[model samples]
Target: MFGFGIVGLLRTIFRSRSLLWSLAVYELRGRYAATLAGSVWAIVNPLVLIGVFWFVTAYGLKVTFEDGPPYFLMVFCGIVPWIAFSEALSGGTNSVLGAAYLVKKIAFPMEVLPLVPIVSTVIVHAVLIVFLLFIMAVNGLPPQLHYIQILYFSGAMLTFAAALSFVLAPVNVFQRDTAHVIGAILTIWFWVTPVIWPVDNLPDWAYAIIRMNPLFYIVQGYRGVLLYDQPFWFQWPLDLWFWACTLFVLLLGSLLFGRLKPHFADVL
Candidate 1:
């Protein structure tokens, strides 16, 4: 049953690949079409937020890291992936509802709805990564071969986000509050995930609990590759745990979305 579910899900996406890319591109352009700044906001928005956080933490709170790279770079590595995930999850959660007209069309593959935002966000994320590398170079931390692991971590992050969207997007169709709840949850999740803070400051017990957060793996993996040049394999246990959780969510989301998909047209 699970195998069929996985196969069916992959087949649906594979068959819709071209349509998916078109929709993703349309969505990306439509977002900033009216603004004067247009697509530039995609890169600017995250940088502005990062700048504010850096100033507040580094100046207001006097937060400093003595043992590693500069605090701004550390925060940037963590924040970049996080912003991408947060945007993907938020946009994917609303994807089905936002395209209500398409949902009413019988031939359309609704499964691609939630994936649209992820594809669009990846474009912006790629740009942000380049900016991050430039910042690192300016700060005297040249890029290394270990940076190649970013591809692996990025795939992991997108997979996890897509799994979550698969679950939340269908649920949001039935209950609009799901979107608001996600916003609140993301705000809280950000604080707990150690994006702006160092994991070393946490006690062993707290660190153990924090390690369970799937996002903790992504954030730490980003830091490991960008700052420490640590290979993804160095943290085998966490890597194992992250994939296990992600697969469970992916399977559950696939089944849940399949069960609920038939009703989406009715509800929307």
Candidate 2:
């Protein structure tokens, strides 16, 4: 399945290189169309949320950590990955259903649809990371060599999004309820994650749970690089485990999607 997915991805790209870019570009334009700020809203939207959360949590609620950094900045750091994961899941899951016309009528590569949302999301994720860099620098904290873990971590996340997309795409085709269920799951998963709190604040068992959270590794990678200025190290066995698991899950997702795809047309 791994080899098939790779070959499938390559073939899809070769067949619809233009379609891939066209859909991505069109999706971007359609999303921000007729808006006053146009493309600028992409960055502004998340920034606005950051400000709101920062204000409410940092000032309005008076939430603070024992040794934690500023409230907003910490939450913002966590939200970056969360938004990408959330948006990617929502978008990727619905990609096929949303593109019903292309899926039912068109004969081009269908995998690209699931990827469109992920691609769009990853672009914004990149921008968020850049903004985070300046935030760290202004605090007189340049990232350390260990910060490079962000890439490997992000790679794992993209793999997760892709794998989940594979699963949800077919699920969305069969049971529309999957979308609602996924939505609720992400909402709960947000709080379940440490976006609002620190892992250290939790008890040992809870901290262990947090450590096992796949998203936790991604969040830690971000903090390790942007906040701690660290890079990938042999001391970090988490990367090895994350990559191994990510690939396995993606392959499994691909197989499931392939096995289920035949019924998608009939069911949808």
What does candidate 2's lDDT look like per residue over 4-57, in tens digits? 965675576568767877887677667899999887787788878777887898
Alpha-carbon deviation at 220 in model 2, angstroms: 1.1
Clash totals, every prediction: 0, 9
Q: Please give the TM-score that candidate 1 achieves against the real structure.
A: 0.97
lDDT of each: 0.92, 0.76
* Candidate 1 ranges with C-alpha deviation above 4 Å: none
lDDT of 2 at 65: 61
Give the Cα RMSD of candidate 2: 2.6
Q: How far does residue 141 in candidate 2 sit from its true spot (Å)? A: 2.7
